[model samples]
Structures are given as C-alpha cells and as structure tokens.
Target: MARLESTLMAFRAKNGFDRGIAAPQIGVQNRFVAIHLVGKHASPQEDALPQAESELFQHELNHLVGILAVNLVSKDLLSADELLNRFPSHVI
Candidate 1:
C-alpha cells in the first residue's frame, strides 16, 4: 500500500486536489482501492453508511469500464438535489 499512498501524495502535490485514486488508474489488478479524505468535510458515518458501501463499489466498477461519476449526472436526467434525495437517509 506504500506505493498507492506515495502515488496519491504525488498526485496531490501536482494537482492540488485532495481525492481518492483507484487502483486501475495505476495498472494494479489486485482489487484494492484507497481513499484519501484529508482536509475535507466528511459526512456523518451513520447517515452515509446506508449508501456508501454500494456507492463505493459501483464507483470502482464504473472506473473499470471507463465511466465516471460526472457521466451519471446530467441536468436532463435529474438535478443534483433530486439525485441526493434519492439515497436512503436515516435523518429527516
């Protein structure tokens, strides 16, 4: 995992964006992924748990097929707020 961390650090240094990088981007087929949430606003664990696991897996699967999150969101299909509201939530 050292190599993954190092690569994430290097990308952060060069791109100035703090986000996670999937293993497929680096040609690793070990089915491992890393997320770097440093210095970001994180959602509450309880609230995020319902959808986080499925979302994370779907996200990685999308990457494997060259699809991105942005591609799934379009004003024609659904607004951002509408999409956010579709996820199951514990708190009203």
Candidate 2:
C-alpha cells in the first residue's frame, strides 16, 4: 500500500495532475486512477468522496486507454467482480 501510494504520487507529479486522490488507494483493483477535477478547481469539498472519485477516475481512464470493449461486455448482467473473473487478464 505504501508503494502504491508512492507510485501514485509519482504519477501525479509526472502527469502534472497535482491532484491528491488517486485510484489505487481505493478499491478499484487496478493500476489506473481517474482524475476529473484538477488544479485550482479541486478542493476539500470536492474531494470529500475519494472512493467515488477513484471509481470515476478508473471509469474515465478505462475509456481513454481502450477498455471500451471490456466495458461494453461487462455492461450486461455481470457484476464488476463477475466481469473481472471472466477477464482477469485485462485488469492491468
């Protein structure tokens, strides 16, 4: 968890995101974290729900990084865990 936090910090710095919340910190169970609001627009109030932010970040990142196929496939009756169980190889 410490290493994950450190890596997330490094990623934020490298991307110039400057946002405090990251995806892996929550329960997204993947390497991608989505950052919606950034820079001066972000605040403590906006960040009150870190888990939601992380989930949203992961959703957006999935879209950006070409996970649409998996997303689409998972949109059916499958729960998130079920989808993951069906395609564990795509997690990273």
Candidate 3:
C-alpha cells in the first residue's frame, strides 16, 4: 500500500493529476490498489475524480486478474516477436 501510495504520489506530482494505482504497476503480483483524494477531490461520501475512481479501480482489478491493457485492443495488435523486434536493443 505504501509503495502504491508513493508511486501514485510521484505520478500525480509529475502529471498534475492521478486517480489511483495498482500493485502490479510496480511489479507486485498482488491485488492492491491505492486511491488518492485531496481537497475538492475529496467529495462528501465519495471521491470526485472526473474519470471516476471506480473506473480506475476496475482497470487495476484487470491487472490483478492477469489482464494486460494490450489485451483490451483487438485491432492491429503486434505479436510478441514483432513487438520485441521494435525494441532498441532492450526489451520491455
């Protein structure tokens, strides 16, 4: 949780805004999510994320369930070999 919080904080600091983060985003193969709400974003009885915190949670949930973001797309997707070939002598 702490790591997620720190990562989320750093992301928000760099990007100006962030809704949440998942453990997998930091290479943790566990199910954990961290949501941040501050000042006006801390709405009464709810979080006031314009993109919706629930949606962010759902995105993270997909990661916990072993669903990659790339899998969500069905058009012009690259195979492992093809994707790896585009790497500049380093692998993702």
Candidate 4:
C-alpha cells in the first residue's frame, strides 16, 4: 500500500486529477489494490481503508498523474500512439 501510495502521490501533484477507486467494490481478487480512480472533485470518504496517511495520499496521487499522462499523450503531446492504443494491456 505504501509503495502504491507513493506512486499515486507523484502522479497526483502533476495532473490535478480527482478520482477514487474502491477495491472491495470491484472485487480485484486481492486486497493489494483497492481504489482505482479519485477525481479532483470527489471527496475522500470515511469508508476508505485504514491506510497510512502518507500511503493513501501517494496512491491517489498516482492516479492523478496517470490521467494527465494519458490525456497529454492522446492529445499528440507525446508520440507513443501504438503503445497507448493497447493501454491496460500493452504494458506501460
């Protein structure tokens, strides 16, 4: 959770995204990753897990950065169409 959070935080500060992902809600097969997306307007609900404060922040952050990166690339700012086209599959 801590590692994932760190990755999220780095991603957040860059993209300004606001989305939240509910792990239990989606049945990810493992508790390793719970939340999926937390957008800029959404609130961190009380139902959230008891993650380390820093870890939670980081995880959300990662999602934010991811959204921004995808948007930028899709906009032609980056040149990796072939790879992006097969996203959530072709590997990052």
Q: Quick one: best lDDT, which candidate?
A: 3
**lDDT scores in order:** 0.68, 0.57, 0.77, 0.47
TM-scores for every candidate against the unseen true structure: 0.51, 0.28, 0.57, 0.26
After superposition, which runs of candidate 1 have C-alpha atoms over 4 Å from their true positions? Answer: 39-61, 64-67, 74-92
Model 3 TM-score on a 0 to 1 scale = 0.57
Can you write out model 3's per-residue Cα lDDT over 1-92, one digit (the tens) per residue?
A: 88899999999899998877778879997889787754455458864445665567677788788887788986977778987887647764
Candidate 1 local lDDT, 5-69, one digit each (tens): 78888999999874566777788866666666434445766444335554765686677677788
Comparing 1 with 3 on TM-score, the higher-scoring candidate is 3
Window of ten residues with lowest summed lDDT in model 4? 21-30
Model 4 TM-score, all chains together: 0.26
Clashes of 1: 0
Residue-level lDDT for 23 in candidate 3: 86
lDDT of 2: 0.57
Model 4, position 17, has a per-residue lDDT of 59
Count clashes in each candidate, considering only residues at least 3 apart in sequence or on different chains: 0, 1, 0, 19
Each prediction's RMSD to truth: 7.3, 12.9, 9.7, 13.6
Judge candidate 2 at residue 41 and give its lDDT.
44
Better of 1 and 4 by lDDT: 1
